[model samples]
Target: MNTIYRLLLVTLFFVSQNNQAQKRIALFNQKDLKGWYAFGEEKGKTNNADELFSVENNMIRMFGPKAGYLMSEQSFRNFELTVEYRWNTDVNVVRKNNNKNSGVMYLVPAETPDILWPKGIQFQIKEGATGDFVFLQETTLNINGTKTTPGKSVVSKRFADAEKPIGEWNQLVIISKNGVITQKLNGKTVNQGTESSVTEGRILLQYEGFPIDFRKVNIKKSK
Candidate 1:
């Protein structure tokens, strides 16, 4: 190849790499819910408006008896997600469960039903230490390539460090890539597992009968 041709090719390659590296992805915009859709109770209330998701005091908060769901517009394959959230005190005069309850669910497939979502694996958000890691729906396999023994579930093997205090803004991080899932709470590794059922799926935030606050929920491509 000629010297000039080689130089031009090298410059083009450099430009391409730089553009990919500099890409700025927006998971959520402050002004309105640009990349999110409301499911469950809040769905019909929006009236097909552009900004369905609401923000108060710079935090996403939920209330009411009926459950709601907020999902990401774009599905993710392999990425690192960081979210911070706190639970708000319940206002129900009937005095049911006053404690906080909510969840950050990941690896959800595209064909999820409108009401039933617990079918997917749930990173629980409950009152006490139990909220840390309670595996639901999905099964966890053992190292021997067999499903885990009778009593134990996948959450036990992956996220023993799931303990977090109530009403506090806890940080949750999920790294999913190539069928491997790892989750952390408050900087502690809580769960790890491998599953081929899904490689990429939409993200969902639970609004199950309690008030919860979400500060930051963002994702970036892993290196």
Candidate 2:
């Protein structure tokens, strides 16, 4: 009888622990753009109307005219986000002479200004700067031990440069919890900030100029 009781208790403990584990959701379905919407210079326009954003060969390709972003329909907080991306080497006319620029923006509030970029914490994705942090609009972050002033934009430099070659894929991992944010590039921790003014909001994949491909955008929520 005691042996049976011990076995039941063990089973119950395992079940409880499993229930408390983090829940992961794949933001990209790898086949369609069902849970995402596009916003750009042409406000109120349809997503990928000009082929700026599309899913082909199991990857999300951003190639077309105008600069904008692809945003998630849902808001999130206290989660870890992982995405893999690579440059396409096809420059648009608008940014023909400039370096490739793009970013992954998160913690975007619902009331963000309806401009090319709203308020959020951006994981900088650009040539030679893949893991930097850009605080857009009025967002602020406490880097190291200094508290940044609000209502102004700031760029927090990454601790290191971890981008792969132009055409090679690189993985970006961002973890946000309790007002603290950490950014990793290619399996290395490159940047981190504390005391974020914005803690929860939507996610944005930027469309700066050159074409970029993204895959495996997944997020795991903390319990």
Candidate achieving the largest TM-score: 2
lDDT agreement with native, every candidate:
0.63, 0.84
Q: Where does candidate 1 stray beyond 4 Å?
A: 1-24, 41-53, 90-99, 129-159, 162-164
Pull out the clashing pairs in model 1: 158-191, 158-192, 159-190, 159-191
lDDT of 2 at 35: 81
C-alpha RMSD of candidate 1: 4.4
Give me the candidate number with maximum lDDT. Answer: 2
**Shift in Å, residue 209, candidate 1:** 1.1
Checking candidate 2 for backbone clashes, the offending pairs are: none
lDDT against true structure, model 2 = 0.84
Distance (Å) between predicted and true CA of 101, model 2? 0.3
RMSD of 2: 3.1
Tell me the lDDT of model 2 at 79.
92
In the range 1-223, model 1's lDDT, one tens digit per residue, is 6999999999999988876644546565545566677776545433332333357776776555566767776777787888888777545422224555678877676665545354345577666543343444553433326444332224444445455566667888877778777778778877666764556777877777667777678886643
